[model samples]
Target: MSWFGFGFNAFGQISGRDRDGNDGDTSIVYTPTEIKCHVDEKSEKSSELRASWSRRASLHLNGGRSLCLAGSNSPSGICDTGCTDAVVGESFVILVFPDRFESWDLDSDEKIPIWSMDVKTLCDGAGSPFNLPLIPGGYIAMTPPFYRPLSPHLKATRLALGAKHSVLLSASGAVYTWGLGSHGQLGHGSLSSEGQPKVVEALWGMRMIFVATGGWHTACISDGGDLYVWGWNESGQLGLPSRAVRKAPKYQTSEETVVTDLPTCGAQPEGEKDTQVFISIQSFPALVDITPSSELKTVGCGSRHTAAVTRAGDLYTWGWGQYGQLGYETSRSDEPYLVEFFRERQLRVVDVTCGAWNTFVSVVKKEVATS
Candidate 1:
């Protein structure tokens, strides 16, 4: 008998494990060619596994619609989509291992060719793939007209993979958004969703370093260390006081009541003299510049929760904890709270990742000194 396993690494590398726990020496590094092959193979295998499990799990779970892994597997080095199939739609979710991409459709149980171009073709000037999987109940939508052209010198680097929603940072420090803008996550000054990518006029030339999107809400970090949030604030997830959701982006000033409107301060250019504010909100805002400060280095967002890692090797989390996703043995909350499990430890955290509910972090142990 042979044991088989599939996993993904922090650097977006995926691998397969056979009975011997060794499978072809890590799949030829992380190049475009190897990545495509890895993804295709994984997607095929995962689709087959899901088809088999859907039959057994649905019967046992009782009224269970489907199964989905719904978490990031990159850092854990383990990739599994579980099983997902429901009357609303009959489709099997496929993840091409190691490629860090996924595909699905309503018609068939087998995986389909969502992308025509291979990795090499995409990397060159050929074209890119469109593999955005549809969210369960969400429908296809588009955003209103808003445009900001990129600098002629900065060629558009097409997306290597297709995502229903993506946070794109341009070379000129602007953030371009597209896909599923209904929740105002696109930051296009409206609630309409968009199929094609559009430049966020609000963040035009702002030198945004990072951007993140939750189911509906969006968050971003400026190069100046200030944090901005917009979209759904129903649970005070925007770190704002009001319950009303805003259709445009707003800056988070302090730890005030739940905010629902745009920030009092407008978007400022990069070199402006502004007080630095670090406001952590539910879901991924943009990637923050953690270099200047020695406290934290990386951060990530889950469906309704957020996580961050400090340079000193500490981890913190806030928001919904229903599934023990916060790594704290407690119930969910509406306020941001520190995860006590890693408060005083000196572990060296190398990476962090999040899924809709679960969080994964990689760390290296410190060597102890002996007399």
Candidate 2:
């Protein structure tokens, strides 16, 4: 799949610059632009666009395919082959091989000989801050010899961790959340923290297929492709109404398609249909509408932004754009809007991944429909 990236690239991470063979380019990509895989080390698998603080990496089933585009890792023998899985964090990178796992510190460029063991595969935990090996009780400084699974079995299909909260999607299409919920991210219609994994009652009975958590927000997708978001909207990350977004400078709207709405989380007070419910924080899972004619294919979240691909191959983004993480180069957006770069180029977006401050998309040429 073709790749396009936009947002923070201070260290050439998103640009993949030097290795990408482009010089004299700025660090931040103001808009969605094409980017090529420029691994210093050869990888057997296709590139999986990933971004971390001041760096970028591409991983595959082989593990740690390319930790850093032009950084060191080749000298180490573990990544050469036989690695089964990998996990990337803000400050370091970890690779899990059948016989051992190695950790690398990106900041110090230190080669740390970590745990050694023969393992089959690493279970994915979340979308960003990359996925770490998780245990029943999180916040552990180290991995225990034998970890315990969730009590009485959770039968979870996916697990996502936010800054202070955790979200779980059960195999039965139910969404469960626990930990910090002061921001209404738990979607229980309140800001009360849940001691145990509590099912989001507001979304009960809906067959949710996917779930994600941001810094203080939670989002999910129903099997039928409806998108639901909640929690903090301080920066409009929830796609709900935002005061910051409404105050965006006029320049940001000069030539962009900006969608604006009353700050409401899909509610109308009794006999107040015309009265918009101003919402700076969504206390429950609020249904968000993007592509009217089609359903969402997939969705992802950044630290303060959200993105999704529609079944019709269109990409939409909302929330913080100070670093251009929204892909539209606007300051901030309270509602979802198309990333016109792809539409103007006739590229059809199929997938998207959000970093702490960057966004990556997988695309292909749009199929031409004819009589």
Candidate 3:
């Protein structure tokens, strides 16, 4: 069977492989550098097990300068090593065994694990469970919470996957969700799995559009521009008073709570309404999207802060700039403050993507007026 090797270099190149032999097509530039590779032992032998070459290997440079790899042992046994310039407290290690998935915090050297069910258990005497043969060359993106799809069509607009997890969208001033929906993120009141696209039942009759997911918690927007959140509300991520998590997921179809409930007083102007929002409620403090207009858009989560982009194309960030992931100049605050301020304020932003801690935006240039 063939093996898979995946990783990102400093120049932002991605590479990977699965059981099938390698073709050079899996290379991409400026993609997230983190990588994962899988191999199926059922495949034949004679596959060359070797490290894939990278065009821009220099980008893999880390302050800690350590190199390590881990996975099932067929080509070789478990591989781990240490190198120079590697950040002592920032790197992570992953180990995949035949039956278990383990992740490590190399900085602290702690092992975190997730269990993988045995093939028999997963199959229940069936031939086999649904499994996708690992494609060795897939790239990885460094996303917050988890790696989520970011469609350029939904730039500045928020989108998320639900529990019965489906692709959810807030576009053209309406909420649309399509995918698994044993949970009510689809907005259909009944607890049923929707194989095809359909408007949410509770939201079916309303002019509401826009949706966000924090694991199970979901939030949506209405045609009147009001916000509605339901599903798992643990840790107040739903911005509602209810602390109980919903088991039989359904769209909580009322104006139950608004986005304003998320931020404390003075986060926004009085009587200023939110036009669009995204919620990421994975852990700690949940993320809240605050888009006042094309010019004023902000995102914040957790205990220490918030982030916003001014209409002028300037990026402003506050709250939890500790890791410099906020793209700020320094990390000295426990409260909200501006970290990165762009000098060119007239640029128009076509899109913004925010992870758990870092945010990315695509902008377009504007012609200057010649006086």
**Candidate that scores best on TM-score:** 2
Residue 236, candidate 2: alpha-carbon lDDT: 83
Task: Please give the range of 10 consecutive residues that has the lowest summed lDDT in model 2.
Answer: 139-148
| Candidate 2 residue runs with Cα over 4 Å from true position | 16-22, 40-45, 60-80, 98-103, 107-109, 116-148, 247-276, 369-371
Give the TM-scores of the predictions, in the order they appear.
Answer: 0.48, 0.78, 0.32
lDDT for 261 (candidate 1): 39
Q: Which model is ahead, 1 or 3, in terms of lDDT?
A: 1
What TM-score would you give candidate 1 relative to the actual structure? 0.48
Write the residue-wise lDDT of candidate 1 on 1-371 in tens digits. 11111122222222323224554434212111111223232332221111111111110111221223311221111223322221111132333322233333323333452322112222221211221222111211112111123344333332111124655555566766676655556667666777666777766667666555555566665666455565554543454432322222257345433333332323433543353322222222332222355354555555555565665666655555555546655444434455544443535555454544445555556556899
Name the lDDT value of residue 113 in candidate 1. Answer: 27
Q: lDDT tens digits, residues 1-371, model 3?
A: 11111222222222433114443334221221123222222323211111211211111212222133322111222232221111111233233232322334433423332212222233332221211111011111111222223344432244444334543443454454555544333445433456644545445456544444433445554544444544433333344332232222254335433342222112434453442222222211122333344234323232222244444555444333343434444442322333332333444443333333333344546568898
lDDT of 1 at 150: 30
Deviation in Å, model 1, residue 66 alpha carbon: 26
Compared with the true structure, what per-residue lDDT tens digits does model 2 show for residues 249-318? 4555444433333223654645555433446678788889886776998887888899989988989999
**TM-score winner, 1 or 2:** 2
Give residue 265's lDDT in candidate 1 (0 to 100). Answer: 25
C-alpha lDDT of candidate 1 relative to the true structure:
0.39
